[model samples]
Target chain A: GDKVKQSPSALSLQEGTNSALRCNFSIAATTVQWFLQNPRGSLINLFYLVPGTKENGRLKSAFDSKESYSTLHIRDAQLEDSGTYFCAAPQGGSAKLIFGEGTKLTVSS
Target chain B: EAAVTQSPRNKVAVTGGKVTLSCNQTNNHNNMYWYRQDTGHGLRLIHYSYGAGSTEKGDIPDGYKASRPSQENFSLILELATPSQTSVYFCASGDAGGNGQLYFGEGSKLTVL
Candidate 1:
């Protein structure tokens, strides 16, 4: 079974709209991280959370270890936001990260 | 800033040939990991090391071997390459606390014909 699961495998949104991506962890994950893979294939770390929530510009993320889930919210989506978003969970006592099947986002103007 | 680098950005090998992929991290992190990303399977860990001379099997360790001869370098070896082993491989380095925040290298693209 996949320890990490991502919702909305693919999504399309009009620029200026908003969308949210979700990740569910079956393992006892202590920390979660989100990454965005751009069209050029460069991966940029978006956010790293140890439970609770954090916001940066038009992006916000929340991780609830007790509930075993995490969410990434995109507001006022821009064309530059188009990419594949991945959420990873580092299980307890393991330095290896288990990644989710990424959610591909397409923001059109 | 943390930096992780991988060598031979691209490689092509024939079946039964030996291939090696190398990774180096200047962060001096205690943990290094190797993962392969394919079309639908996402990224699957192949091997990881806790420190120098320590290599451990990951989720998909079959057909792959790893070497961690030093703290700064880790290598993935395909002793007998096959076409099915072709994929983009990424090396990442992280601290010892199991944090999900890992610094990754610009991946190495491998093709086994």
Candidate 2:
């Protein structure tokens, strides 16, 4: 059983459209973080949440510790948004962060 | 911004050969981790360390070994590289405690023939 699971393993969207990605946790996660891995394989941190929601520009994320789930929403998606998205959850009592398999997004004009 | 760098961005090794990947962090974080990414498995933890001279086994530690000789450096070694070990390896550093976020390097791509 995976501690963290991501839905819609892969997604495709037309530019300017909106989309959402989800992550479900089997473990008791205390904190969650989202990252976007560019084609070059460079991972850029998107959001870090304890609980509740946070928004930055066209991206927004929410984490519900009680439900053990997290969501990342992209608004007015652009071609540059094409890349792999990952969500990581920190173990309840450890400093380690468990990562989801990742969701690959391909946005085209 | 926290900086984490990995050396030998790409590597090629023959079966039964030795392979080592290195990671360094300028953030001076206390926790470091190693993970391998495969097609369907995602990112699987291989090893981690809390500080210099400390190494802990992660979810998938077999066939691999790790060394944390200093606070700024961590290395992953494969005594006998196999094709199965061929994948993209990632090194990350994080601050202490569960609330802190982890910062990652670009990654090292290894190919075993």
TM-score of 2: 0.97
Per-prediction tally of clashes: 0, 0
Model 1: residues with Cα > 4 Å off, grouped in runs: none
- Tell me the spans in candidate 2 whose CA falls farther than 4 Å from its real position: none
DockQ of each: 0.79, 0.77
Question: How do the residues A46-99 of candidate 2 rate in per-residue lDDT, one tens digit apiece?
Answer: 999989999999999999989989999999999999999999987766866889
Chain A vs native chain A, TM-score per candidate: 0.98, 0.98
In order, the Cα lDDT scores of the candidates are: 0.93, 0.93
Worst 10 residues of 1 chain A by lDDT: A89-98
- What CAPRI class is candidate 2? medium
Q: Kindly list the per-residue Cα lDDT of model 2 for residues B1-113, writing each as its tens digit.
A: 88999989999999999999999999889999999998888788999999999898888999999999999999999999999999999999998875688899999999999
DockQ of model 2, rounded to 2 decimals: 0.77
